[model samples]
Target: MSDNLLSRFLRYVRIDTQSDETSKTFPSTPGQLVLLEMLKQELTELGAADVQMTRPGYVMASISANTRKARVPTVAFLAHVDTAPDCSGKNVKPIVHRKYDGRVVKFPDKPGLTLDPATSPELRTAIGKDIVTASGTTLLGSDDKSGVAVIMTLVERLLRETKRKHGLIRVCFTPDEEIGRGVDKLDLRMLGADVAYTLDGGPPGEICWETFSGDAAEVIVDGITTHTMEAKAKGMVNAAYLAGKLLAALPRERCAPETTDGRDGFIHPIHVEGRTERSVVKFLLRDFELNGLADKGKILRGLCRGLQASEPRARVRCKLRKQYRNMAYWLRKDMRPVELAREAFVAAGLKPYDHVIRGGTDGSRLTELGLPTPNLFCGEHNAHGPLEWVAVQDMESAVSACAQLAELWERKS
Candidate 1:
């Protein structure tokens, strides 16, 4: 089973499915559709029923219960297929460290690249375990692929074990999650699951039930263009200078990513493009509380207004768009799923730690769609980068935990 998990994970990561954030298409990349078809075929071969790969690349499958129980609530497991666009996902080559010696492991070909324990203290816990990593070139794509492997392995285990009783289990692989548009084309009505769990978190035995309310802010500054040789104080109000002023005017100590923590709001500038004639600044705003989110937007607008006043010759425009809300609102009302997950982890001989996610997940958006979904860990660390790695023991534990979760759900609902 361990070999199967690693083999499947390695196979899935070899396919380049990097999502395009700039694409107007549903799946974002055509490569994601290819993987979706592969998963659909594999599920069919594993004897899963109702296997369907939608046009926009949403793969759905179901496993019927072997028990005679009636009125059992259906459960679903979800994971995304596309990897982060932060790094290249092409031609990923994974290397396995067998029985690690609690020392820093370096790439054989790249002497300068090494997984330093001093930099990442978390390596101590994974000592004496098998770890899969990239070749210090491309990301390993374990963020959600590990979750995919967990669900697939659990389903295969259930099918092989004849006596294991479970209700209908639905599984889905979504696309474009890295760009925050994963569930935009999701058909929840057809999914028909009473509740679902997204196996997309990091670290083993970690569960996340809360996330930040997110939004994007764009500020455009238009100015008159004048030749640099003929530039004067009032003749040309440099839009780039105006953009810099606006960025500086934002709460320096308070609204920064490095200084913020739990429940703290932040305004992160993601993109900046400017010239003397025109400039545009793109930022992402995140807050755990609704009122705080509104206040952050107001602060951003106030900065733009102040910049307009300082540079009267330049025109300033601000646009704020709400993305997704905090999942805590739904999790608070229904704590049964959280309790069930905790019990499942204990049953699988692992310690469960519950925390609020620093970033958003597909579970955040699924909760608002009336699913009340929460995120479970798949043991991948340093995601979206070339240094990504996942322990073999942790992956096995995740598969066991997923199987136990299905049984726990059967007993409760």
Candidate 2:
């Protein structure tokens, strides 16, 4: 199982599935479709039932219930197929260090790059386990690829265990999770599951029921452009300059990703584009609570209003788009899914504990949509960057946890 899991992860990461946020298409990338098709074939080969590539390129499949008891809930397992666009995910060279010895690991592709336990405290915990990482030039794509491998492995194991009693299981592979469109087109009725879990968290034994309530803001500053010779203080309004001023006015200390941690929410400026005539600045507002999230929005709108007041001739429009809300708001209403996960982790010989994600997941939206979905870990660390990695043993444990979770649901029902 370990060998198969490692092989699957290595093979999957080599494909460049980085989603494009600017693409108008449903998936935002062609490479994602390639992987989705491959998963569809793999699920069929693994003897999964009703395997098909659904609309918007999601791979959906199912396994029949082996339990004799009637009225067991249908549980779904999901993982995203797309990697983040934050760094290069192309031509990834995954290096496996068998039995790590608490030594500094260096990247051959980057002479100056090294993974040391001194700075990476997580590596210390993985000293005796097999670790997988990419060459310094590219991200490892373990953010959800590890999750994909874990679910695929789980499917393979459950199908082989013909005598194992469990409920009907649904497996889904989604796309564009990195860009936050993972479940936008998904039809819940077609999924046909009472509850779901996204294997998209970090470390081992992690059960994340809480996430930052997320929203995006686009500040467009449209200013009048004039020739340099004819430019005057009153006649010329530079949109680019005002955009910079908006950035400058953002809370530098309190509400930034770099300065905040734990339960601290942030207002992150992700993209800035355009020139003198028209400039657009994009921001991401995140908080664990709805009111905190709204406060962040107000801060950005106030800044835009200030910019508008400074130059009445220029138009400063702040547009806010609601993304996934914090899953805790819904999960707290009924924690059966979380509790069952905890029991399953214990069954897998893991000391399970609850965790809160600073970022959102597909489960966030699923829970908000009345599915009561929660997040489970697949050993990914340092996600969305060159230093990302996952331990093979951790992924194997995740597969075990999911399998145990299915049986627990069966027994409880």
Candidate 3:
């Protein structure tokens, strides 16, 4: 089982399915469809029925139980196939280190790069385990590939082992999840699961029930451009200066990523482009609470109004668009699946730790679509970076957890 996990994870990561945020297409990149087709073939070979790859790279499969149980709830397991756009996922070389020595391990390709224990405090807990890492020149793409391996291995194990009594299990592998457009083209009716769990969180034994309510703000500043040789301040309004001033007016302590954690809201300036004629500033606003998020938006708009007042000749326009909402809102009454997940973890001999995801997941949007989905871990850490790594043991445990979830759903029926 462990060998299967490692081999499948390495195989998936080598496919280079990086999502394109700038693409107007549904799946974002054609490479994602390549992996989706491969998964469809693998699922069919594993005896899964109704295996299909949709137009936008959504792969769906179902495994029917041999037992003659009545009214068993159909539980689904989901994971993303595309890697993040933050780093390169091409030509990935997975380096497996057996029996880690708890020291600073260096990559062969990049001698200067090493996994330092002092910096990554999480390594102290992973000592004496077999881990898979990258070659330090590109990301390992372990974020959701680890999840993919867990689901694939669990399905194979259930198909081979005749004694495990489980109900119908649906599996899905989505594309473009890293770019916030993963669920945009998802067909929930085709999936047909009463409840689902996304095996796409970081680290083992971690469950995320909450995610941020997010929005994107685009501020465009229009200014009159005058020739450099033209007389002093007569007809010149520097748009770049206006952009800088608007950014500077924002609260310094509340704008940085490093200073925020655990339900703390922030305004992150992601893109800044300027010329004399016009300038554009892009920011992402995130908050866990709805009322607080509304307040934050008000503050941002107030800042823009101030900028407009300060620059009479310059025109400033701000557009704020809501992206996704907090999943916590629906987790109270619509969270039986989360409770089942906790019991499943305990049955698998693991303690479940629930945490708020600092970012959004496809599960967040799925919950709004009436699936009532939550996120589970697959043991990958430092995702979207060259230093990303996943523990083989944790991956195996995740597979067990998934199998346990299917059994629990059957028992509930």
By TM-score, the best candidate is: 2
On residues 1-413, what C-alpha lDDT tens digit does candidate 3 reach at each position?
88888999989999999999779997888889888989999999988889998876799998887567988888899999999988899889999999888999799888899898898878777888899899988899888999999999988988887677788889999999897888888899899998889999877778898999888889999998888888266689988889999889888686556678877988888789999889999888888888877877887899999999998889999999978888778887767888888999999999998978988899889987788889999998889999999888999989998888888888877
Clashes of 2: 0
> What local lDDT score does residue 221 receive in model 3, on the 0 to 100 scale?
96
Which window of ten consecutive residues has the lowest lDDT sum in model 3?
A: 250-259
TM-score: model 3 vs. ground truth:
0.95
Q: Give Cα distance to truth, residue 328, candidate 3, Å.
A: 1.6
Q: Between the candidate structures 1 and 3, which one is better when assessed by lDDT? A: 1
Which candidate order results from sorting by lDDT in descending order? 2, 1, 3
- List, residue by residue over 1-413, the lDDT tens digit for candidate 1: 99888888988999999999779988989889888899999999998899999876799999887767887778899999999998899989999999988888888646788898898788888999999898888899998899888888887888887576779999999999998998988899888898899988877889999999999999999988887787885497789989999888878698888888877889988789999899999998999998988989999999898888887889999999878889999889989889999999999998999878877999899998899899999987999998889898898999899888888787776
TM-score (all chains, Cα) for each model? 0.96, 0.99, 0.95
Question: Which candidate gets the maximum lDDT versus the true structure?
Answer: 2
Looking at model 1, report the run of 10 residues with the lowest lDDT sum: 225-234
In model 2, what is the error at residue 87, expressed in angstroms?
A: 0.7
Local error of candidate 3 at residue 388 (angstroms): 1.2
- Model 2 ranges with Cα > 4 A deviation: none
CA-lDDT, candidates in order = 0.89, 0.94, 0.87
Structural RMSD, model 3: 1.7
